[model samples]
Target chain A: MTEAATTRRSRITPEREAELYEAVLDLLREVGYEALTMDAVAARTRSSKATLYRQWGSKPELIAKALRHNKPTSLDEIDTGSLRGDIHAMMARSDDCQMDRDAALMRGLFHAIHGNAELHQALRQLLIEPELDHLNTLLRRAVDRGEVAADNPALDFVIHMLVGGFVARDLIEDRTVDREFLTSYIDAVILPALGI
Target chain B: MTEAATTRRSRITPEREAELYEAVLDLLREVGYEALTMDAVAARTRSSKATLYRQWGSKPELIAKALRHNKPTSLDEIDTGSLRGDIHAMMARSDDCQMDRDAALMRGLFHAIHGNAELHQALRQLLIEPELDHLNTLLRRAVDRGEVAADNPALDFVIHMLVGGFVARDLIEDRTVDREFLTSYIDAVILPALGI
Candidate 1:
């Protein structure tokens, strides 16, 4: 490998990158996007500021990269032979992770994303679209299987249902989107709404 | 009336308060919470910074007071004697107002609320709680009339459905929570989820 490639590879192994992302996510949770600094991330992760800047260039980009890397695999693992099965499995799998911290991170980023175009675009591109696309794929499969009507109006708002609980949890109740909450949500809200 | 009461009443009439609130909301939309200034509000409303400061004491109090004063009446009017009608009526009435900028104002306050405990508490108490309480009241009335089951599981999450649309609208689709969207949401996801 070229000297630059060699340095880059040796500098940030996949495990080290994951550690750095975790530190970034932790900082993001502790301090919001506007207050989170690259220097802080580097210090917290015991890395050089030069290395962080060389890797991500800016705070927003670095934060986005961190979120992108930390995304749960449940988004990509929803194909369980049926819509109900897929949703239940996804919700179940998603429940197996630490969600409150994730919700807080997403909440922390909310205010920053509104005013920053580049950060907004990066967040959308990196974190939101893939999960949304996965839901759409599952819905399409349901339609094809006659489990859900192809012209169902509810399809348009399923993302709202799936994602809304997280956004409104703080506003509605002082609770996390825990397994119990998700299970009640799927059975009461998602399944019945799906009419399956 | 006493001299102080007479002077206060004459100086800050109900109409004057509404005008000041309007100016604050407008400035909040333009510059957001961090950048918005008492000086700008004073200038926009043709008042003095001293007057603004003497009245509100701080930016959060000013914005919170502005929001409290400008809150729509739809929250109180969702008593149409039927669950579906009440929801549709509430949705329709909420739609009748200038929603986009209201949503924008809410968005602008998002970041500030997360960081400022005083602001978050004020927002939830002054604005969110009253409206949410109204929703709860409507649901209770529906249950009393047997339009909904008192023990329905979806009851816990109806807030998530109604409020989630606004929270996730921009995040899910590059759109505002408009009338048609609310109408479709009510018909498609909400009513069905409620088993109505």
Candidate 2:
């Protein structure tokens, strides 16, 4: 291996990367994106700053990757016979506490994403696009089943609606996003829009 | 007038309060909620720090009151014979540039709101609840007109959907929240979900 490759391989094993990412997410939850620092992450993980810089490049990129790493399952792995069943099955994967924590993490990230263009680009490319592709796959299956029409404009905004439901709940009602709420939202708002 | 009234009248006239709130909003846009301080507002408006404290009580209250003052027209005054007309008129009240500025301001506030309880309470009490009350009036009109069922679950979530549209546009699509996008979203996602 080249010297650069040798250094990278020595520094970041799969387990080590996972440990670092967990530290990053814990710091993210504690202090949020604005207050979090590379120095903090390095100290938390007992790694050098140079190692983190070599591994992740920058704070935004690190946070973006950490968030991506935090997802419990790939949306692609979820497959149920019906679109409604698929959506509910997806929601069922996480318990209430996990959903609450993930919602809180996302709330902070949304603001950071707005302010930082690099973070926004990294998240869209690394995290968002992949999930969207997975969601589109689900939608494609639904369309093929003739559950939703091909010309439905609501298909274009499924992510927005889902994300919106997650976000607007706290802002408007000061409520924790839970499976009950998501299930109700999916049925009332999402399904109706899709003409299901 | 009592001594307290005299002191208050001397420090702040109606016009002076408007000037201070305008300065506060300008600073909020430039620096965001966390960076904005009473000292900064006092400096910008040429008011005493003591006077500001006595008037607004806290930063959250000041920011919330300023946001309330920034509204162009009350939602209650926005009756246009039909719900669709009222919604469109509300959209038309602000031009594209103003909408862009407001949406960006809101995006920053959403993050701050998630973290700050006092700010959230002030905003809900001073800004959000009043708007929701007005929106409820609009929905009530629709229900009375036989346009929508009062029991529809989506009725409870119109604000969520609207707020989500404003927020999710930037995060997901990386697009500016414009009239065209909102119009399409309303027609496709919101209206259909409402069974309108």
Candidate 3:
């Protein structure tokens, strides 16, 4: 139909798209994924609902874009020579990244993802996949540098430890992920687990 | 109110109460926590809703009773002579005490507990508090035995590693807890983390 064609034709520049995505993150932090609506996002960003619909197609897609925008890149790249130093730097980088409000937002996102397959997939792609990729890159570097064995049995457990530690601290213990905990975790658990 | 007092006066005996609680667990596993109701529990147990109401005031309370009934008791009394043996046994016990169709029920419970504060408290008391108490007791024993120093730096991290490992495997990886993972986890991570 002509209407569908018009909706598809109205495209914004990349700069405006990034601005809208940033606005979505702000809204997500303020209102959470469950309470967020396209109307609210459009109103906040001074855009139209039609524009959002044409661009993202659905609420999950919109929230996925927002999560991707705010996704932490603290562990992207670090070459501290030794595996211990690299892990130390990686843990320290994530120190200031822990926000109490973020935990609430994460809980909201988690609730949104449960029972909704589309949202779950979108969340894994935007949020979970990126972190996994970054950790893989870091571990791959360690393997190449001969810091850890190429076929280390504990390699699989490292990622689980990092993520599990944070989630358990937040959800179970109801505490912020602290720097002291991260540092000792690296020295005591991570390095030893990986047999480095 | 007089009605409330009258309702409280019609309490059932402990044996009948246990039967009703078991029926609630069956309904929860079969139909899920969200779909579960007092009527369904009463019908399943061949009891009246009045008796159910007299025993437990709310749906959350009923579910809490079911959880308490099914909770593992050995997790609290893990004194296997050594800290390593105690932790290994504790972690491995999760594999033996299996619940039928529990994964789906747990997922449903996770969703149900998010927004409901009373349910959250009840779940913490029924599910989480027992495990925490057991772990705390084990750690206290370790401290008393001087196997681990009183000023052990990685105590919290070790606890997190053990508990977090299983939770993450279940929630994120969608895997069942097994003894092999638990043994490797204790040997590779917990032992070194405690400098054993």
Residue-pair clashes per candidate:
0, 0, 0
Residue B141, model 1: lDDT of 94
Model 2 achieves a DockQ score of 0.61
Instruction: Tell me the tens digit of each residue's lDDT in model 1 across A23-85.
Output: 888887777676677778878999889888887777877887777676545465557788888
Per-residue CA lDDT of model 1 for B1-196, tens digit only, reads: 3676456546688888888888888887766676677788888999888877776677887887787677554455557789989877766765535677766676666656766777677667755777777778888999999988888888888888877788778775766788888888888998888778
What's model 1's lDDT at A117?
72
Give Cα distance to truth, residue A104, candidate 2, Å.
2.1
Residue B43 displacement in candidate 3 (angstroms): 11
Better of 1 and 3 by lDDT: 1
TM-score of each: 0.78, 0.83, 0.69
> How displaced is residue A128 in candidate 3, in Å?
2.9
Instruction: Name the better of 2 and 3 by lDDT.
Output: 2
Off by over 4 Å in 1: A1-24, A37-62, A65-82, A95-97, B1-21, B30-62, B69-81, B115-117
lDDT of 2 at A134: 78
Model 1 RMSD, rounded to 1 decimal = 4.7
The candidate that wins on lDDT is 2
Candidates' lDDT values, in order? 0.75, 0.78, 0.67
Q: In model 3, which regions exceed 4 Å deviation? A: A1-62, A65-76, A95-102, A111-117, A143-152, B1-79, B96-119, B140-150, B170-174
For model 3, how does the per-residue alpha-carbon lDDT over B80-138 read when each residue is reduced to its tens digit?
89999988877666543452244345444544565566766666776567777888788
Candidates 1 and 2, the one with greater DockQ: 2
